[model samples]
Target: MLAPTVGAEAAEAVAGEEAWSVHMQNTNVLQGHTKIRSPYYGTNSLSQAPQMRQTVSLDLLLGLRLWSGAEAHLDGMMWEGFGMSNALGMAGFPNGEAFRKGTASPNENISRAFIRQSIGFGSEMEDSPSSSLFLKGRQHVSRLTFTLGRFGAKDIFDSNAYANDARTQFMNWSLMANGAWDYPADSLGFTTGGAAELYLHDWVLRYGFFQVPTVSNGISLDPHIWKAWAQVVELERKHKIGSHPGAVRFLVYANRANMGSFQQTLNNPLRPADITDSRNYRIKYGICLNADQEIATGVGIFTRLGWSDGRSEPWSFTDVDSSASFGISAKGTAWDRPNDTLAIACIVNSISKVHAAFLRQGGTGILVGDGRLSYGAEKIIETYYDFAVRGWLHVAFDYQFAVNPAYNRDRGPVHIFGARLHWEF
Candidate 1:
C-alpha cells in the first residue's frame, strides 16, 4: 500500500490520477511445527503431531470513482488450504493468513464491496496515493467519510504501522490485531455494515455497526438486525514526539447475539461440556487500546491491549478474554536493504475464571479447547525477517515459540518455523 501523503493538493496530482484503479495481490504461507510433548489431545487442540501446513490467498481490488467525493470498491478474493490444527488450539494462533474455514480447493468470494463518500471540510489538502483500500487523489485533511456495504471491521479500526498486515508483518492472530476485540465478522472475517469516520487534523473518531453471526463463529449471519449485531466506536489521535510520529487508538465495542454462556455451560455440563447448550440472546462488550510509534527513522514500535467480558462465547473472532502484546519493527536500512524488514513481538493471552473453568470441564471454544485442563496463560514469542526479492515480490522467514499452548500448561513449549511469499501490483 502507498504511504499517506499529507501536504498541499496539487492540480497535476489530481489530473494525473485515473478515474478507476485496479490492484492485485497474492500470498502463500507454509508453516511447520516441531513435535510437542503432549500426553493427551482433544478434537480442537493444536495437533501435537509434527506436521507442515500451508495456506494461499489471492485478492483483486477494483475501485471506481462514482462522483466528486464518492467511490465504490469491489474486492474479489480466493483462499485455499488450512492452518495448523485448522487454526485451533491457542488464543494467539500463529498464522494470521489462515482462516478456520479451510478448503481442499480454492474457494472464491466477494470479500469486500463497499461505497465511500468523503466530504471535505477545509481548504487545506493532501494528495493521497493509490492503494487497494481507497482511491488516490487530493483530499482534505479534515473530512467526514461514510462507508457502507460488505467489508472487514479490521479494515477500518485498530490501524497499526508495525504489526497489522499478515502478508508483510507479524503472522500471529493476536499480533495482527487486538485479539480480544472480537470485531464483527463471519467465518472469512467479512461482514455487512456501515462505518462513519470523522477526521480532524490531529484526531479521528469512527463508529461502525455491522451484523454478527447467528450462532457462535457461524458462517451465516442472523437476519434479525436489531437482535443480532455489533457496534463499535474508536477514537484515534495522531501525534509527533520529538520529531517522531505516533498514533494511539481507544476503542469500545458491544455485540448482541444468541451466544452461549460459560458459567451456564459449567453449571450444567453436557456430555462434551458444550457451551452452546446454554445459548441465549445476550450482550458482550469489551475495550481496546492500540498504539504505534515511529521511534526513529525506519524503526517503529507497536503494542495492543484488549479485554472482553467473558460471560458469553466469542461470537466472531478467536477465543480470548484478555490480550496484551508489544513489539518493534525496523527496516533493513541500516544494512542497505530499505525494502527489507525485521520484527519481533510477544503476546500474553488469558481467559476469565468461568471461561477457563468451562474448558476444565471438557468444554470447547472456537479455537482453544482440550478434553481436560491444567490452565495457564498462553505466551507467544514471534520474530520474522522479510527479504525483498525484487520489485513487488518478497519472501519472508518466520519463527514462533508457544508456551502453555491453548492455555494448557500441561501441553507444550512448541517451536514453529514458517516461510511466506507475497507479490502485489
Candidate 2:
C-alpha cells in the first residue's frame, strides 16, 4: 500500500516510543556470459556458460532517544544468498576453491549478523537510515561509534552505490576493481570481530579488526586468517563555485586484509614444492574527488575520480616497486516522482603496467617473477535501474561488462547481469 506524506503524522504518533525502520530486498536472477579469447591472448579458451544466481537481504536501523536532544542508534544487515563469479579465480592460483564449490560466484556466500551503536552528544535528528545517527552538537566537533559484532564495510563514494555487504556481484565487482578489498568469497570474506569510528570536525577516521579464516584445510565455517585490520580517514572541504549546488570531497584509506594467506593445503593446493608466494600484503594510500551539479528540477549529474598507491605491491611480494591505479564514475538520476526514480551510472578503471611487474610466482609455475604477469589495461562498465513500485516494494535491473579482464588465462571477462525485487518496512 502507498502512504502519502506520513512523515509528520508518524512523528506525532511516535513521540514517546523508540523509532525503528527495516528494509528487505530479494532478487532472483539469470545470467548469461560469453568470454571471447583470441589466439593472441593465449593458449586457453573459455566456455559460454549460462548461470543462474539468487539472493535475499535485510537492512535495519534502530533509534532511541537518550535525552530531549540526543539519541542512541543501532544499525544492522543480513544476507542469505548465492551469485556468480568469485574473484579468487583471479586473485592468483589456489584461492578459487570457494568459488567452484558454490557452482556460482563467491560473493553469494553469506552475511554474518551485525550491529553498531553510538550515543549522540547533541540534539540533531535523523529521518532516514542513511542520515547520520550522531547528535547535532557531537557531529560538529567529535563523535564516537563502536561496533563489537560481525558486519560488512561501507563505501566512500555513496553508501548505496557500492555494495556494503560484500556478498554479491555488484558490490564485489566494484570493490575488487578499485582494489578496495580482497574478498574471494562472501561467506569466507568478512571478519568476525568489531570496529570503532571517530569523527572530528571536517575529518573522520575509523579503525577495525576482524577474525578471518586461516590458510588451512578447514571448511568455510573455520576461522583462520587470525586477524584482519582496516583503517580509513576522510577529510573534506566543500567549496561553492558560484550559486550552483557544486561541492568537492576528499577521501583516503588503507587496509591490511589477510584473505587466507599461504598454506600447503587449500591456499597452496599446487603442492608446497610448486606453491608460489603470491600473497597480497598491501599498504595502500588513496585519494578521491566528488562533485555534483543540479542540472534541472528532477535531474542531477555527479562525477567521482579516485587514485591509489599500494606501497607493498602485493604482486611483487618483496623488493618490488609500488603500484598505482585510478578510476572514474559518472552518474545521473531522474527523480520525477516522489516514489519513482531512474538512476544510471558508468565507471572505468586503469592500472599502470608497472603493477604487473610486482606479480610473483612461487616454485615452478607457468610464469615466474614479473615476466609472466602483465595487465596492459583492464576496464569494466556497469549500469542499473531502480523503480519504486510502491512505498514498500521495488524492482531493479543491472548489467555489467569487463574488458581485458586482468589475470591469467584461467579466468574469463567477468560479465554479469542482475535483477532484484525489494520490500522495506
**Which candidate wins on TM-score?**
1
lDDT of 1 by residue, 229-279 (tens): 999999999999999999999999999999999887777836678887889
Candidate closest to the true structure, highest lDDT: 1
* Model 1 RMSD in angstroms: 3.1
Clashing pairs in 1: none
Q: Output the TM-score of candidate 1.
A: 0.96
Off by over 4 Å in 1: 1-14
The digit string of per-residue lDDT tens for model 2 on 322-374 reads 22222222222333445544444444444433334333222221112222334
lDDT of 1 at 252: 97
